[model samples]
Target: MELQIGKYTARISVLPPIHPKFRITPEPAAPNSTDGEEEQIEAEPISGFTCIIGYTSGGGEVSERLITCRSLRAHGTGLTIGAICHAAKGFRAFRVDRISAVSDPHTGEVIGDGSYFSRFAVKSSDKARAPSGGWGLTPSRMRTLVAGLNVLSFIARCDGYWHALEDEPLANFIERLWMRKDWEGQPPVAAILDHAKRLAPDSSIFFASLETIFGSRSSTRLLISSVRELIEADGIIQDQETNWVLAMQQHQEEYYARKGLLGSI
Candidate 1:
């Protein structure tokens, strides 16, 4: 299966029920069960399996990856898989719902139904510990931060030249305002900023994503305040940047008003 996300395209393949490295163990039956009665059985935890997937990131970039999934955990209304991502060369948390497609790594067959992973559910505690620098953020919150950063990148590029002065404040702002202290090292801020430049010409997609991901009044307020600070960081506020921020604020206000939350933010 082929999926499009933002400007990237990925071909997804499906995994077969049985692979040489994959195994499933049935749950033991309950004690004192009647012989004629049907018994419910659950599959044991999924330890590890290699598969190919088209994953859409929080920043709206999509990439195909070969991953060895180590565990599954309940996340909000969906599931999160902890995996060793070959492309990233690190353990990462991937929300199951954001997996555009999954396929067999060897054969490249498409898993049209996407139901294979849903059958093996596990508690959040079962997930493997991520390596250092993992932000330990939920997928939704990560999306919000990424989208907000993209907007900041847009503002930095509004004057057609990115000022060197903006970089430090941008980095400091992200660490101080958004990240948790325990999250050991910095996020991929440089990569996100560079990627945002490529998408800056038409950044409405990010704004739309941000609107959809907005969770609370405080988050919205923080984003707007951050944008304002970024706009003044280089000692120059372009007309374009100011106008864009205003439009964003107006859109957010209307959004909350429509949801009967105008008074909250």
Candidate 2:
């Protein structure tokens, strides 16, 4: 299946299911709730996993969406998915039956209708043992991670144009931190990229705010190395990229100096 939205196109191939018999049972309604009202059955939250779906709205308009699924629940004969739509930049409820296709955003692999919900149930159960709802990182650590990624993204776009090759280094950096291939409970890469693209135009203010989030030397070094790889990915070194890196280093040094500590990078 080929999904085209404006200039972007993706080829999705359907993959066989690993758990064919998996199913999600809707949780019972609240004690005071009345009939006909939708009950939200909370399952283990699935973060990081994103899917692109060809959807036909109730009004009959057809479109493609990139969604980061947050929750799923049984609704009548089908299922309702609660997700953050990348294009819409907000949470939405999508009916499974209205969806024509569900594809992986990174690999473009189509997930069968039954297999899509099944995989969610299986992953939710598998990750039930983990204390952290997603990514296994604490709230503070996750914020720092996002801030670090934002810093790297700013450096990647320092040259004015964001090269396609830059995404490879960013993806590699995330994979190194979390060793997972299924895309479940991973970082939202698309959202990050979109945010980076928007903020790249005015980086001084954005970068300055992100700089305060990192207070450790190890993380600072990792971010610097990652930025270097991103800038070099396109094979053309720009003076703007080099200058931003130096500025980041200098800022960190000044920050640590104010705290009476050596901030050698």
lDDT of 2 by residue, 1-265 (tens): 1212212111111111222222222234346433221222221223223566788899998777766554566778667777655565445778888888776544455755533553333222434244333245543444455556556655665565667898878876666544422234667666545433332212322244345444666556666677779989999989877766666666666677878887555
Query: What lDDT, from 0 to 1, does candidate 2 have?
Result: 0.53
Q: Which stretches of candidate 1 lie over 4 Å from their true place?
A: 1-136, 179-201, 263-265
Best by the lDDT measure = 2
**Residue-by-residue lDDT tens digits, candidate 1, 78-121:** 88876645555445678888888876654456653234576445
Cα TM-score per model: 0.44, 0.44
